[model samples]
Target: MNKDIRITFRVTPEDYERIKTKADQAHMSVSAYVRAAALRHKVVVVEGLKEQTHEFKGIGRSLNQLTILAHEGRVSVVDLDSVFSALEKNYIGLCELAEQERR
Candidate 1:
């Protein structure tokens, strides 16, 4: 087993509240969250829409396969426009979500 060291630090009340809020939003304990932040690690907090998001990912995978098949002439034709548009929209939405989480 690896050994660990404990470190202590002080923060202003406002800073403490801010850290607590972020930790809550990330669904992590304050110490773990703070440690990760101090270590310059990336913290991803995926909120809600779990089932739907999973289904959306499956759809994306299918679209990717379809695109490859269409290019290979395995499929007579596939509407590339609609597929790309849907993917772009999903990408944009995820970006917006990440931006919101950052704030």
Candidate 2:
């Protein structure tokens, strides 16, 4: 910011403390931390989600392989069902998180 555009905002003391800690960890001043947060845009949010999506892709590949192995072999179907249930739960959780992050 070449010229200061002063604004006032409010948050809990605990949140201020947490931001202070994070700024210290990142070697930034609290003002910089707040400024960065205020400037966060949809592109930055999407980029963060892209990284998480990569993890989901890996999980999908592993699940696909497991499904193929179960189908080809005489493996117990109950175990596969359980795996799918867990995947469903995780997928729902991820969806919730992604939805919450949308601008």
Residue 90, model 2: lDDT of 65
Off by over 4 Å in 2: 43-103
TM-score of every candidate relative to the true structure: 0.42, 0.38
Error of 2 at 63 (Å): 38
Model-by-model lDDT, in order?
A: 0.80, 0.75
Tens digits of per-residue lDDT for model 1, 2-98: 5388888999999999999999999999998987898896657667446447657877799889889889989986667876777677777777777
Error of 1 at 3 (Å): 15
Q: Kindly report which residue pairs in candidate 1 clash with one another.
A: none
User: What would the per-residue lDDT of candidate 2 be over residues 1-103, giving only the tens digit for each residue?
Assistant: 3856878789899999999999999899999887787788544444355655776787788778877878989554535575577668667767877777763
Lowest-sum lDDT 10-residue window in model 1: 46-55
RMSD in angstroms, candidate 1?
Answer: 13.0
- Candidate 2 lDDT score relative to the true structure: 0.75
